[model samples]
Target chain A: MAATMNDVAQRAGVSVKTVSNVVNGYPHIRETTRARVLAAIEELDYQLNVAARNLRTGRTGIIALAVPELSLPYFAELADSVIQAADAQGLTVLIEQTGSRRERELEVLSGARRHLTDGLLFSPLALGDGDEQLLDVDFPMVLLGERLFPDTVDHVTMQNVEGARAATEHLLGLGRRRVAVVGVHPGEVVGSAGLRLTGYRQALEAAGVPWDESLLGEAGLWHRSTGASAMAHLLDSGAAPDAVFAMNDAMALGVLHELQVRGIRVPDDVAVIGFDAVDEGEYSNPSLTTVDPGREQIAETAVRLLVEQIADKRGTHRPRRVYADFRILERRSTLPA
Target chain B: MAATMNDVAQRAGVSVKTVSNVVNGYPHIRETTRARVLAAIEELDYQLNVAARNLRTGRTGIIALAVPELSLPYFAELADSVIQAADAQGLTVLIEQTGSRRERELEVLSGARRHLTDGLLFSPLALGDGDEQLLDVDFPMVLLGERLFPDTVDHVTMQNVEGARAATEHLLGLGRRRVAVVGVHPGEVVGSAGLRLTGYRQALEAAGVPWDESLLGEAGLWHRSTGASAMAHLLDSGAAPDAVFAMNDAMALGVLHELQVRGIRVPDDVAVIGFDAVDEGEYSNPSLTTVDPGREQIAETAVRLLVEQIADKRGTHRPRRVYADFRILERRSTLPA
Candidate 1:
């Protein structure tokens, strides 16, 4: 018979949970306790096979992450961090792409297919306010990103509003009273764009500057091309603000590309800033000054929370929302006072 | 009463293997035979509740891909394509990260975790010559990438050697005799760097140019930082090569950035090229000239092969080696003489 975690725990006079914690490399556990657990395992010659142990817990030792796509480096890096977190917990990750379509997102929730995996980390893109029914899903799910649905579920979001406010205020502090906002959707009250837009408005009002509708460049999809085209539209309309703030880094890149193409020097002619501390943002032509939303932290927290839920299958914890921090990284794109 | 595959085969006057082939989507099968099998399945309403159908097949309706890491855009996008291709064939993919470690790569092939999936698509980074025994494991497996181990398994490889030859020859054709190579090891005999170096030598010989060992810059890890560091080293050594070829696009981007930092213009001062057709490569400052090794074809072929192995328990016609095509994408990074 194979030696089990219980055998090691018994030999060491410690609980089975302590052995598990040691094997998992939990950050909070004491080094002495971990040493003791390792010694006991050596004495017992116990092999801590995660798959075998998880089988007893009725888990496949696997977790699934359903995201819009990995073609976008933002989601790609996020998935990488999530996989790292899961791997530390001895859980393998299975990724599924739903194309951000609401129907497809809902199908993954339905769990009609094989449920060999323990839970899902979902990031829904094309889902909208009307799809609130998906919130009542029974399976363990951790929703990522800033799209708040009507139904209740565990969600992880960035400090979009606060971050956006900082971005706008930075331009204002640079004495750019007339600042252009890229990647905006008018009259919207939720989502990352809407929340960031509200923050932008709050910043302008707080700074005693009037909000001009002409300075609000609405780019329907928050992509690089949209940013470039919207910047072109803003420049063509003669609403030349002193500075610009794009809601996301990709848009910021598009804006930077457009400015460079039109022979306009960044910061000197038009200061530019973006949201999301994307790696590409750091290496952009002028190195964009942007908001660094804590993407990795959110990914790690979501995985830990899911593992907790999986461990305590019947435990009742109210569905909670976690908001990660955001910081402004001032690089070359933005003008300094 | 539930009907079995054998019953369907008997009723349709076909061999059991033929019935299995029809069910698994073998491309070589005749259309009429497929129709006859479909007719039998319809007569029985053979629902594809693969979840319940294969309790006895001892195979999970899942395929696993073990990659070194997803932090690299090449691996990330490769995993994405693999997942999409798997989905098209009505299969799910479980991705395991090896962190490019030898131990983790071997752990993934242990075959003890049998209940989770039916087949595996493995991409090993650190597995050396001694680990060739892994190829003989008793499971449905498909190896991917440029690393060629002892041959006892189904393998899919990108055109690393030939693609490198073409890239080197292209640069040489532009009258660049003294060329530098980034993301290379001094004497690596295994994996991509070694194979591509061989191809580079072949191109140099074919062009009647002597291979200068000084031209090979050391990049232990083919990452962006390594590329930047390698370029810096090359420049500081006062041996300015006319052109540079980095192994992959991300590292190439790093080279491009370093060149810009030193006030060296691209395609004019020193032309540069890279492999891997990443989206960012297309949108780089001057765009990137690189090889588009058939990533999509690899995904489709791997998934199709894995699905066949899963549906065929007897393991007939197990594809040994699958080679995909490679194409050169002409962009602003490389210019013609």
Candidate 2:
């Protein structure tokens, strides 16, 4: 049989609670005591049965990150950052892909799987305002992405409106007019697409450029294929805008590919800008100009908030909302020189 | 109090074993009994404590997938496929990123965290022959990627050598000589880079072409930046080849970006091909020609094998090896017209 906490405590001549404090990384343990406990554990080759400990203490040292999909570069990069941040906190992340389905999102919230992890970081793409009450669960959860529910859960989100406005202003500042927007979800007022479209309108109004409904290209999903189809629709309809701002880098890439297929020179015929400064954007054909929404910061903040909630066994802490700063990353796509 | 198996059994007018079978998703249970037990469970809102169930039966209904990183498009896509495959089996996946570190890989093998999941699908990049013995663990683990260990764990891998050879042959068949290979790891004999390099050499020899040492561009990591730097080194050293074969799609993208920066027209000045037919390859400037190594099939096969191992509680099954088929995807990068 493997050595237990009692064995380690006896070997180190310390109390079982002390040994547990060291094992659980309870931060306040003394250096010499921690060293002695560690030495005893090493001497006995004691492997803590995480499942049993979790059953006893209700802390698994694992957090679940529920995202729409990892195949999407945005979520993949976000997951990477979250994992790195969680690792720094001596925690591991269990990824749950909801497939952007409302039922799956709801299932993730109320499923028995919640008992397996201490906290959840949820980024829902499909669940809307109607499901806001679903966030009122017993577990600790930090909401991510553009979806917002007031006074319900802790939220770490990007400045979607400000970032999109900045991206449009950057394109307009480059002496380009008649800016077209790709990835606009018509009638959406709260989601990412709608919020970003509002920002685009704000930038256009600030620059004294009238908002043309024909310049708004609709996309159901913020994917590359959707971006390509939107760009195709704009070009085929002869609503040729001098500038185009895609909702995200994935869509921007599609727009670039479609433009290239049409032999249109970027920054020469039509300048392009995107949101989400994904790694692939740096290596894209024209090296995509995009908005850095401080994804790493958002990830770190969200993990920190979730960890705090998990640690707060009393459940007295109030929900908080934090927004990551955003900046425009100027690249070859918008700048010729 | 929440409903226990006994409570569910009593409420459903069935035996405890029948309720257990229904709750465990046993296929042999009668439809009427299943409905009664499910109805009782819903009436009581009984949430099965996964931690307690895991402690009792030693089954967490969770499988872990340990990969190098998800930020890499290849692994991200593989993870997506794995999740889909696992979901079909009514199992959830917990992802662990090893960051391709040997110590971390070893930690994952021996860590107490192993008890938290039913099985593991490991894809180690840094571990090699010296660590093959580590595969002799008590838990069920299925190995993925090019890292192979004989007579040990079950492996589901892509045809690295054959795929690379076909990629090279495709480039050669395009009437191109002096093919420069990018993303070669010097002194590697067993990993993906070395095996792919061997295939490149075999293709050159088969085509009556001599192996040129200068044509090999060494990269420690198979990333886009490495590919770009390797391309730049080849261009600066005046060892310009008519064709370039990147070990993976990420590096191929880098090669394309670098080639474009040098004002070099693809297929006219230089033809390019890459391995791993990732989604991004289709949207690249010239639409990357690549070797599709059957990644989705590998994921599905690996998950199925892992599930089988998990179901074989008696430890009666022997280790097996499986390889997915590979094919070359022809695109505009290799054929200008």
Candidate 3:
């Protein structure tokens, strides 16, 4: 059986109330009495009931981070960063995987676990139209990602369009026309895919290159396999391109692999660039060129915003939106250094 | 302000006690009354105070999964599997990242958050020496990985030695004379690195190939960068190896990238195999060949054992040690099909 306050009190030769006072850090206790109580508690290994204490304090000292899934290296690394940021503030993080599903994302915002966590750092990938009002909750929450922009909640996001534009312009600057794009979600207007596609079109217009629908490689989920399949589809459809702009690094790596499998040389036959400079890209064959989306800044800013809301307690602070700066990281996949 | 039981009662035209009964799912409540209470709850968006309910039931519908960190692909994939398994059992998982540090690992077992979770699924990477006594906690825990073996707790591990041996033997079967191993932690006898190195040596001895210490690539962490550097070190030391056995898939991918950078052809020049069949391996340049350590089974079995302990309530069930089966997944990295 686990030790209780009564066990500690009995071991310390004191009353239950005295032991409780010592455990709760009451300042009126004598030094000798506190030391004896501490020794007894350590000897018995008594644990204070955090749930009961939470009822009085209205704080759980824990935060929830809701991401799509950990299998994706981006989200996994983001979760790692959030945990480190939270740890610096002396808070624990609980992770929730929404699987990029609409229903699960709604359930997360329903405040079902509000009693257990002070606030949440939520990144919604499946919430689109008609989900704005649902984002407004009584509990403290800081939204992560470039999804919804509800004025009632704080949001931390990256420079999606600017970063993607920079990546596409980097390819165009290398004198590469007929650039192909991978991981395009048809009809998307707000998510990463849509914003990035817009940037690609802008870059093409600036370079006086015509936009060809044939060069757009449609893919779903943005996984590596999907990227490879998309590349195959583009090639099989006879859309010969001089360059490829993959939406993310995972897909970029996949595209590189597919090209290598076909014996097509990178930067010589086709140049490739991706967004989200994940660690794997640094050691990939040809060393992938990608955009660094300021993941660390996003993690830190989201935690800071969530902590602010938690401290306000009244939810009266006007919701703020913060965007992290991004940069292009040039590597061998684009051109020879 | 959040809605309370009184607000729900007022909206439903019922007493607070009746609302409480309906919320608690009492069978004695009338259907119409229950429907009215439920309607009020839906309209007001009221949530039950889970903390108070947990105190009464002595259970929290939440479990914790503690891993080294999510940045590593292996641990990220493992966390993904565990989350899916927990979801199937209708349990929510709260993740804790220990950063693979000994102090943090000890803190996780110190029962600091015991009141907030019903059980813990711990995968410690740094706990060693005299830390077995710390594993004897009063809470329900199922240890994951091969880091520790305590008689008092259930354990779920992969076939580290056997899997590594199969990988080495596969490379040797390709008529490769000198086999190099990556991600070796020297003079260790327990962890994954140590056990895998042992398997590599055993395979060499069984095949009548002399053991060459020069081919053992020392790496602190089994990350891709480390793996690439280890491969570089082996090459710089003039170890002309025909085959390489990387400890994990991430490192194997790195080794492939390193070899490609040096204009070395895979399979024709050096055959490579890795452990941990990660998803990224499927899309690598040569499509990595690795050992499938039954990750899905490990996740499912660990959750089953943990749920059983939670159900037992009295902690009377004997502990169990389960080893997931493993198999060699031959791909292009090994040899021509």
Name the candidate that leads on DockQ: 2
- By DockQ, the candidates rank as 2, 3, 1
TM-score of each: 0.82, 0.94, 0.93
Model 1 C-alpha lDDT per residue in residues A257-337, reported as the tens digit of each score: 788768788788899999888787766667789998998998999998888777767858678889998899999888473
lDDT of 2 by residue, A1-337 (tens): 5578899999999998899899879999889999999999999988777878888887888899999989999999999999999999989888899888888888999856778888999998898767777889888999998876767899999999999999999999998888999999888888899889989999999999987999999999888999999999999998989999999999999999999999999979999999999999999898999999999999999999999999998899999999999999999999953
* Model 3 segments more than 4 A misplaced: A1-44, A148-150, B1-40, B148-150
Candidate 1 lDDT tens digits, B70-117: 778788889889988988887888888888887887788875444567
lDDT of 3 by residue, B1-337 (tens): 6788899999999999899888877899889889999999999989887777777777878889999889888899999999999989988888888888889888899878898889999998888656778888888899997664657789999998888989999998999988999999887778888889888988988999998889999888788988899999998899999899999988998899899899988988999999999887887878899999999999999999999999997779998999999999988999752
Error of 2 at A106 (Å): 1.4
Pitting candidate 1 against candidate 3, the one with the higher DockQ is 3
Over 4 Å off, model 1: A1-58, A236-238, A335-337, B1-55, B316-319
Number of backbone clashes in candidate 1: 0
TM-score of chain B of 3: 0.92
Residue B52, candidate 2: alpha-carbon lDDT: 81
DockQ (Cα-based) for each candidate: 0.27, 0.78, 0.74
